[model samples]
Target: MTPQPFVAMKNIEKSFNGVPVLKSVTLEVEEGEIHALLGENGAGKSTLMNILGGVHQPDNGTILINGEEAKMADPRVSQEHGISFIHQELNMVSDLKVYENMFLGSELRNKFGFLAVEEMCRQTHEILAELGVNINPKEYVRNLATSYKQLIEISKALLHKSRLIIMDEPTTSLAEHEVNRLFELMKNLKKTGVSIIYISHKLKEIQAVCDRYTVLRDGQLVKTGMVENEDLETITKMMVGKAISQERFMHEHPFGETAMEVSGLTSTGHFKDIDFTVRKGEIVGFTGLAGDGRTELFESLFGFRKKYAGEVKINGQVVKIDHPRKALQAGIGYVPKDRKENAIIKDLSVIHNMSLSSMGNFERSGFIQDKKEREKFDVYKKALNIKVHNPRITIDKLSGGNQQKVIIAKWLEAETDILIFDNPTQGIDVGAKQEIYQQIIALSRLGKAIIILSSEAPEVLRICHTINVMYHGEITARFTGEGASEEEIMHYATGSKREGIAIG
Candidate 1:
C-alpha cells in the first residue's frame, strides 16, 4: 500500500453573491515539504485558504488527512485536525501579554481548574528560542515591533502542535535580517516533518523558501509543479495571464513650477531635517526599508502629526496645516497607507466611498443628491475600469485593486493640486498595477504634483521622476529615475551610506 499525502483539498468550489471565487480547485501537500500557493490579488487564494481554515464552507469538496475524509465545521475542528492558520493581519490582542496571547482560547489549567501561567510562559519561551526570538514572555504585545508580533503569530501555530501550518504573507512586515531568520526557522520546521502552505506575493521569497508551487488564475488551478523547474517570469505569467513589463515609466513631461516645498521638516523622534520639492506635473517617490521614517514623514506632512516642526510651502507660499481639513483646503490630499484601516469605510456603499472626500459637491440644501453622486461614480468607474456589479453594494465586497481605485477617485474629485499616495499599490496585483501607474501619469500630465511613498524599489523606479531614499529619519540619497539602481537605493536605505550636504 502507498502512503497518503498529509493533506489534500479536492474539488473545492466556493462562490459569493452568485460570483464563483474558487472552481474545482485541488491542492495536495506532502509531509515535510514547503508548498507555495501563488496567485494574483483576487485570484481566489484567500477564498480557498479560508475554506481550509474553516472560516467558510466550500460548496462542494472533500478535505482529506492521511487518506481519510475529514470534516472541519469550524476553526476549532480545524485546530483539532492539526491545521493552523496565521492570517496576514494578525489576530493577537494588543493588551494581552505574549504568553497570554499564545494560549488565548485553549488555556492550560491545573487539576483544581486553576490557570497554569508558569507552564504557559515556559512553553512560550522554548518555542520562541527555537526561532531565535529573545523576548520576555510576560511583555505586553502592544510594545512589540511588527516583526516580533509576526513571530508570536507563528509561535502560536507551533503551540497548537499543528501538523500543517498555513502562513499568509508571513514576511510582509519583516526586515531583511528578520526575514532570513524566519527562513531558517521554516527550514528547521520542514526538517521536523511539518508541512507548510506558504502564500505570498513576493516572488523572490517564494523562490527561496518554497519546495513546490501551485499557481491559481481566475479561480482555477493553472499549474502545479516543482519550484526548481520554473522561473519567476513563468510563475508570474501563470498568475497574471501575461508577461508584466518592468520598463521605466519616467518620460519628459512639461513640468510646471514647484507645487509643494518642505524645508527643515523635523519631528523630534520621527523624522528630521527633511527637505524636498515636488513640482507640478512630476511624480516624486520616497523609498526605504521598514523603520526608515518615510511613512511618518508623510503622515506629519498630511497633518496627522501636529507636533512636527517644519516649513511647508504650497505653490511657493508658506502654509500651516495643523489638521487634515487644513491640508485638504491647501490643495494637498493624502492617500494614506494600509487602505483597509486608514482609507475605506467598510460599511459604506461603493459610490458613497468614492464621493466621501468631496461630499459638499454632492449636497444640496444640506441633503445628499444621490443622482449626482451616481452620475459622478459612473464616470470614474469607467475611467478607472473598476469591476463592480452594482454601485449600491458595500465597498468591502470589491477586490483590493478596485477598492484602491475608488479611493483614488475620491481624492481626484476633490481637485487637490498636490496628491500624496503612500503605498498606493500595496496589496494590488501586477495587471492592476499597470492601470494605476497609467492613471497616476495621466494625473501628472494634467499638472498635479504627486508624491509616492513605497518600500519596493522597483515600483518607485518604474513610476517616479525623482527618487529619494530615507534611513533612520534622514534623507540619505537622491537620484533621478534614469540613474537610480536598486543596489544604490539599498545602500542608503539600510544606512550603509549617506550624503554630507543637505539637498532638496
Candidate 2:
C-alpha cells in the first residue's frame, strides 16, 4: 500500500506582469525522500519552489503539508511548518560571526531578554561537528571559504529541524571533494526522515543524489519520473521539451594575434601564479568543476579582485589595473555569473542596464548623463534582440534571456578590446542560447579577445579556439583547435595525471 505523502503541491500557477511563469505544476515529496526539481534556466522550477517557501504567492494552487492545507504568508510561516530554502546565492551576513549568522534572528535569550551568546555558540559548534565540518562557530563567515559557508548554511537549516529542505544550486561554490561530502550528508539526512528538494544545472550530481526528479519547462510540468529510470539524454530532452541540438553551440573559430597577456597574476583566495594569453578572433574556453577557481581568475583579471602578485598586458604593452576602473581602462569587459546579483539592477530599464557600465562615455563635464549617449546602447540593444516595449521599462520584467542579453549589451557598449564572459548562458532557453552564441561569434569576428568559462563541455568545444583545463588551482592541460577533446579535458579536470604537467 502507498503511504500518504508528507507534502504536496497541486495545480500551482504563477505569473508576473500577466506572463505565466508557472502553470499548473504538481509535486509531492514523502518523508525520507531526496527529490530533485529539474529544469533549464528560467523554467519556473525556482518559481515553484519559491511559492512553496512563501517567497512568492502562487496565482492558483493548493499546498498541503501532511494532508493538511496551509498557505504560507511569509518565509517564517514556511519555516514554522518545517520547510526551509537554501538559496544558491548565499545570504549569510559575512561580517557577522558564524554562530551569529547560524542563529540569526532566532537567538536564545537569557531571563532578562539579553542575548545568550555562549549558549548559541556552543550549540552551533556541536552542529558543525556533527556535520563533519571543522571550524569554530565563532569564526567570521566572511573569512571562511565558500564551501565551508555553504556547510554552515546547511547546518543552519538543520538547526530549524526542517522536515522539507529545498537547496537551490548548492553545489555551485563547492570544491569537488566538498561536493562528495555534501552528497554523503544528504543521503544520511534522507535516512533520518528529512525530505530534500535539490535543484541544480549540474546533470551528473542529479544522477547520483536524487531518487526522483520533477521536470519543469516554460512554467509547466513536463514530467516527473524516477532518476534511476532515466539516463542523462532523456532528462535533457524533458528539461527542454524537445530534442535540443547539444552540439549546435560548438563551432571553433580560426583565432589570430595575441590579444591579451597575463604574467604571474595572483590574488589571495582568488587565484595564484596565473599566466595565460588570449588571441583575437578566438574563443578560449576555461573549464573546471565548480569552485575550481575559474571565475576567480577572471575576477582578478577584470580588476574586481585586486592583483597582488602579477601583471596584465594588452597587445604586448604593460597595463596598470589597480581597480575595476583601471581594468576597463585597459580595455577589458567582464560579465558576471549571477545576472541579478552582479550584472543587473533589476529596478532599472533595459537600456539603462545596457548603458550602465559604459555610462562614463556619455558624461559631460562629469555631470549630465547625456540622452544622446544612450544611442550607443541602442545599437547593441537592438542587435541582441531584447524583448521590451521600450528601454524605459524596468529590467526585472523582461525574461531571463532578455536580461542576459542586456548584460552582454553592457559590455559591448564599452570600447574594450578584450572580454571575459563567465557562464554567460547559464539560465536561458535553447533558442536564446543559440542567439547568444551567434552574438559571441559576431564579437570574435570583430577581433575581440574572448575568454569564456563554462561547465558545458560542448559549449567550450564549440566556441573556443583553445581550451584550458584547470584543476586544483592550476592549468592542467591546454588544448588547441585540432587537439581539443572532451574526454581528455574531463579526465585531467577530474585529477587524472598526465606527464609534463606541474602547476602550469
lDDT of 2: 0.79
What is the per-residue lDDT of model 1 for residues 80-190, given as tens digits with 9 covering 90 to 100?
A: 888999876668899999999999999999899999999999999999998778999999998997679888998899888788999987876566777888889889889
**Positional deviation of 334 in candidate 2, in angstroms?**
1.9
Indicate the TM-score of model 2: 0.84
Candidate 2 lDDT by residue in tens digits, 238-298: 8866665556345555667898988887666755667788888878789887656788788
**For candidate 2, what's the RMSD?**
4.0
Worst 10 residues of 2 by lDDT: 495-504
**TM values, all candidates:** 0.91, 0.84
The lDDT for every candidate, in the order shown, is: 0.87, 0.79
- Which model scores highest in TM-score? 1
